[model samples]
Target: MLTDVQLRRLTPREKPYKLSDTGGLFIFVQSSGSRLWRMKYRFGGKEKLLSFGTYPEVTLAAAREARDQARVELRAGRDPSLTRRQRQAEAKRVDKQLQHVGEEWMKAQSARWTPRHAEDVRTSLERLAWPDLGHIDLDEITAPMVLETIKKIEARRAKETARRVRQRLSAIFLFGMAHGLGRHDPASVIKGALAPLIKGRQPALIDLEELKHLFHQVELIPAGGIEEPLIVSSFD
Candidate 1:
């Protein structure tokens, strides 16, 4: 049981010395006066050491909380260190086909969006989502992963950017699915996870700009073509 006062008073010796705490947690005081927190544990017949972090910066209570979390993971039959490493390594592998799917989706969709807006959407995904998720398969990228990426923009207090980026993500997923490149829209699962944008700002589901674009798209359809069947069926 090391108190804060005792922790502050701990002096560096000729070599590293560990001040023990409960549950195999301890602080290693190095000869250079640096204090680091570590936990000793065993799993699958192998002894392991987990590094908590530096003392004071991580804080005693925070280190204990992290240790308890690791214990919970251990109880659940999971290796916390391995899980962390997997998450950290997720971005290193690139899936070129899925990135190509994104580019194809953009090219097909660019006709529906203004040139500037298309660039904006592409840039948002490239800046925030692509680094973490562009490498993952469309169906393999989970909702939690999309939520995590969107939350980064939210964290920066860019409410509008976050909102638009989330929309773009969902549209991309839907586009991929329509083209048989994806099975689901993970972004749609995290719709309300972000902080809500200003209420009643646009104030219409079919706003003027969207309405114009809708009409423009409709006009682009060839007369007496496949669209005539849909419009005729609409009356029936």
Candidate 2:
């Protein structure tokens, strides 16, 4: 067991040192003059060391709390070290999958989109959606996660961009499902979640007399070569 007195009386050394406590826990002093806590345990017939973070920073109580949490995990027949590693591996896999999906989605839409529009779509997805939900398996993505991503865009008052992002994500999920990379398309379930934009009625016009008057006024205006025609056609 480690006592408060022993922990408090501990001094820094030029070289790293270890102070063992009861059970498998140990306090490690690094050459950088910082103290860290760790636990050595046997899991699956192999030894594993789990880091509990730095001392003074983690504190005695916090260290004990972390140790207890690890013990609970062990009791459940789970290896904390393996769990951490698996999570990291899964995150990497998801990142790769998203990159592939994004590329495929861009290619599929390229023919129908203008050059600038295609570039903008790619940029928006890469900058916004890719960072948050990109590391999640397509099948595992929830409605709330999609909503949260849209909320981020909405926060910037980007209504049109948000709508396009949702559409792009839906397409990605559909593509993933087609290739067996995903199960459900949460984006499909939440369609019409955003507010609709209303298109106002067209301007009302008078009879032929008013039209002729407008045309006469237009003819009376002095023209400066093609510039005047270009300006006049812009309003039409």
Candidate 1 residue lDDT tens string, 154-227? 77756556666677778778878887778899899998788886544344433333343335446556867754
Instruction: Give the Cα-based TM-score of candidate 1 against the true structure.
Output: 0.44
TM per candidate: 0.44, 0.44
Across residues 44-123, which tens digit of lDDT does each residue of candidate 2 receive? Answer: 89998999888778887788787777787899999988777898997656644755777777888788765655666677
TM-score for candidate 2: 0.44
Clashing residue pairs for model 2 = 1-22
Local distance difference test values of all predictions, in order: 0.74, 0.72
Worst 10 residues of 1 by lDDT: 227-236
